[model samples]
Target: MRIGIFGTGGMADALGAHWARAGHELLVSGRSAENAAALANRLGAATGTWPEVAAAADVLLLALPAGAVLDVLAASGPLTGKVLVDCTNDPALTGAPVASRIASASPGAHVVKAFNLAPTDIWQLTPPAWEGRPLSVPLCGDDPAALAAVGTLVRDIGATPVAGGGLDRAALLEATAAFVIGLWFAGEDAQAILAPVG
Candidate 1:
């Protein structure tokens, strides 16, 4: 897969590094050309402008800040039929779900909400695991093909993909992220809140 990383932050570095190791071609671009080039060099990938990367890649990862998503997506060229993986989380974002918002802004792009539940350090783990179990990633998207593509990427990083229903449920995932992240910061075991059902 040809993956386009639309940021230079920690999420971009961690995820991009894994995908690069998995033999995917990567194009990295960010607000800072120098930063993008640096990240690209680190991942052994290429650097390009947002529009150029958007045009050239099969799948695009929006590892950018939630506040910058719409503006950056708008600036990127038309994303018709592209698989767009949204990993942004913002507790303050009201109104629509971030992935839904991205879908609306891109028109024809297939948007999948994923990689938002955990911290960047977790993703840095080679196939994140706990208690000898592979970490399960939840994904929300409307298109089957798009979901499958993102699921493959999730597996590429050595995690299991859990079907999280459609795009309408994305806000639920976002809310869960906010809740669990808050718990983590509070030094609580967020996982303990949910027990295995009989």
Candidate 2:
């Protein structure tokens, strides 16, 4: 897979490393060319302009902040028929899911919402395991092929991918993230809030 990551931040570095290790070709681009080059070097991937990366990749990871997603995509030229993976989360909880917004902004692209629940530190984990089990990631997307592609990437990072329904349900995932993040920030054990079902 030719993966284009549109940021040089922690999430980009962590996920890009895993995909690179999985033998996927990578092109990293962002607002800062120097930072992108540095991250590309660290991941053993290539660095290119946003437009070039967008055009060259089979799959594009919008590893940017929530506010920057639309602007960056607009600047990256047409995304028609692209598999766009949205990993952004809105801390403000202001509106719809970022994936839905991205889908609206790029109607021709297949947008998949994923990798937003975990922190960058968790993604840095080689297997992202917890309690002797691999972490389960829930993904929401309308396109079956796009979902399957991202599912492969999830397993590439040694995590389990769970179906999270269609694109319409992506807002629920965002709300879940906001709630869990609040609990985490409040020094509460979010897992304890829910018990296992028999």
Candidate 3:
């Protein structure tokens, strides 16, 4: 897959490593060319400006904070045919409906909501984390074809993909991230907090 990742932050770098390991050609972008190139070099993926990266990818990962996502997408131009993956959630985000808006903007493209429920380390699990085989990643998207494509991406990163159904289900997905962050902020251990789910 010709993948492009925006932000080049921890989550972006982590996910990019998984793709690099899987032999995908990855292009990473960030606000700072130095940081982006550094991360790209560290992960053995290609590095370029954000617009260049966005234009070249078959799949694009929005690895920015929720507050900045909309502007970033708009600045990147009409992502009409790209597979847009959003891994962001801000408790303070306002007036923007991402999944539908992104889909509408992209026309024939598919928008998927994912990777926001857990920390970056979730992808670094030594023994893959699904219930039966490894850890299961729950994703929600309105488009089935897009969801399936995301499932493939999630599976590529050594996770079991759990389809949480329509894009509206992101309400649950967003709230889940809040709860997880709360638990982590409360100083709970992974085993203790994830006990029920894990």
Off by over 4 Å in 1: none
Q: Which stretches of candidate 3 lie over 4 Å from their true place?
A: 93-108, 127-133, 189-198
The local distance difference test score of each candidate is 0.93, 0.92, 0.77
Backbone clashes, each candidate: 0, 0, 4
Model 3 scores worst on lDDT over the 10 consecutive residues at 124-133
Clashing residue pairs for model 3: 129-134, 129-135, 130-134, 130-135
Model 2, TM vs. native: 0.97
Which candidate, 1 or 3, would have the higher TM-score against the true structure?
1
**Residue 2, model 2: Cα distance from true site in angstroms:** 0.5
Pick by TM-score: 2 or 3, better one: 2
Best first by TM-score, ranked: 2, 1, 3
Could you tell me the lDDT of residue 106 within candidate 1? 90
Alpha-carbon lDDT of model 3: 0.77
Model 1, 122-176: lDDT tens digits are: 8888877776677899999999999999999999999999999998899999999
